[model samples]
Target: METVIEVQGLTKSFGSFKAVDHLNFKVAKGEIFGFLGANGAGKTTAMRMLCGLSKPTSGSARVAGYDVQLNPEKVKQNIGYMSQRFSLYDDLKVEENIRLFAGIYGIPRPLIKTQTEALLEKLHFTEERNTMVRALPLGWKQKLAFSVAVFHQPKVVFLDEPTGGVDPVTRRQFWELIYEAAAQGITVFVTTHYMDEAEYCDRLSMMVDGRIEALDSPQQLKEKMGVASMDEVFRLLARKAKRTE
Candidate 1:
C-alpha cells in the first residue's frame, strides 16, 4: 500500500517547552492507525501539526503527499478531521450541517444534494434530517459529526478522541463506521484513551512525554512488552512518564 502520511524528525516547541520531540512515523493508505497516549503526552500536538492546524518547529511531515509546512492548504484539502469537541453547529438542522460541510470541503454544488442524501441514508439519519443537531442524542450527534467529517471523501481522516464520553454500545457502532471507511480506502488516524479501542487498529503508536515510546501492532506490542493486554502494556509504558513520578 502507498504511504499517505510520513513524518521525519518532526518536532514542535512552545517557547522553552517541547511538545513533540523528534517524532517519526508513517501511515499507509487505507490503514487504521491508532495513536495512544495519556494526557500531556503530545498526541494532540503531533496530530495538530499533521492536520496543518499548527506549524512544526523543525523537520518535515508529508500528509496525503503534501508537505505540512509548505502546502498546508493542499494538505487540508485532501484530509478530513473530527475533533474531540464534536465540531458542529448546534442550531443547524442535520441536513443543513451536512450541506455546510459539503460546501466547506468544496464539493460541487450539484453533487451536494445527492451526497447529503446518500450520507443520511447510510447513517440511518434520513428521519432526523430536519431536526436540530442539538436535539439529537449524544450518540447520534457523534455519529453524525463523523459522517460530516468524511462526507467530502478525503484520502485521510483525523479523528481526535472521536468516541470520548460515549457509551460502550455507541463506541462499538462508531468503530463499525470506521471499519467501513477504511475498507473504502480512507486512511484512519485516531487517538483514544480506551485500550480496547486501541486493539482494533491495524497498528498503534504509544506516546509518552512528547515522544513515541512504542510503535507496533497491539499483539506485537503485547508480546514485546510481555503483557497480556493493551491495558497492561499501556499502564507499564505510561507509568514511565516523568510526570507520573
Candidate 2:
C-alpha cells in the first residue's frame, strides 16, 4: 500500500519534560492505525503535532506527503479531525453544522446540498437535520461527528479518543463507521485508551513514557509478548510506566 503518513525521530519537549521522544512510524493509505497509551503517555501531544495543531521540537513528520512543520497548511488541507469531546456546534442544527464544515473544507457551494442530503440519508439522520446538535443523544452525536469528519473526503482522518465515554454498543457502531471510512480509502489514525478498541486496528503502536514500546498488529504483539489479549499486552507495558495518567 502507499504511505500517507511518515514520522522519523519526532520529538516534542516542554522545558525538561519530553512529551514525545524520537517517535518513528509510518501509516499506509486506507489503514486503521491505532495509537494506544495511558492518558499522559504523550499520545495527545504526538497527535497534536501530527495534526499540525502543535509543532514538533525536533525531527520530522509528513502527512499526505507534506512536511508537517514546513507545509502544515497543506497537511491540514488533506486531513480531517474529530476529538473525544465530539466537536460540533451545540447551538447549530445538524444540517447547519454539516454545511458550515463542508464550506470550511472548501467543498463547492453548489455541491454541498447534494452531498449533505446523501450524508443525512446514509446516516439515517434526515429527520434530525433541523434539530439542534445539543438535543441529540450521545451515540447519535458521535456518529454525526465522525460522519462530518470525513465528509470532505480527506486523505487521512485523525480521531482523538473518538469513542470516549460512549457505551459498548455505541463504540462498536462507531468502529463500523471507521471501517466504512477506511473501506472508502481514508487512512485512520486514532488514539484511544480502550483495550478492546485497540484490537480493531489494522496495526497499533503502544506508547509509554513518550516512546513507543511496541508497534505491531494486535495479534502479533500479543503473541510476541506471550499474551492472549491486547489488555494483557497493555497491562504489562504500562506496569513499568512512570506516568500513570
What are the clashing pairs of model 2?
40-245
| Over 4 Å off, model 1 | none
Q: For residues 1-245, could you state the per-residue lDDT of candidate 2 as single tens digits?
A: 79999999999999989999999999999999999988799999999999999999999999999999999999999999999887999999999999999999999998999999999999899999999999999999989999999999999999999988899998999999999999999999999989999999999999999999999999899999999989999999988799655
Per-residue lDDT of model 1, residues 1-245, tens digit only: 79999999999998978889999999999999999999999999999999999999999999999999999999999999999996999999999999999999999998999989898899899899999999998889999998888888889999999999999999999999999999999999999999999999999999999899999999999999998999999999999898541
Candidate 2, TM-score vs. the true structure? 0.98
lDDT of each: 0.94, 0.95
How far residue 98's Cα lies from its native spot in candidate 1, in Å, is: 0.2
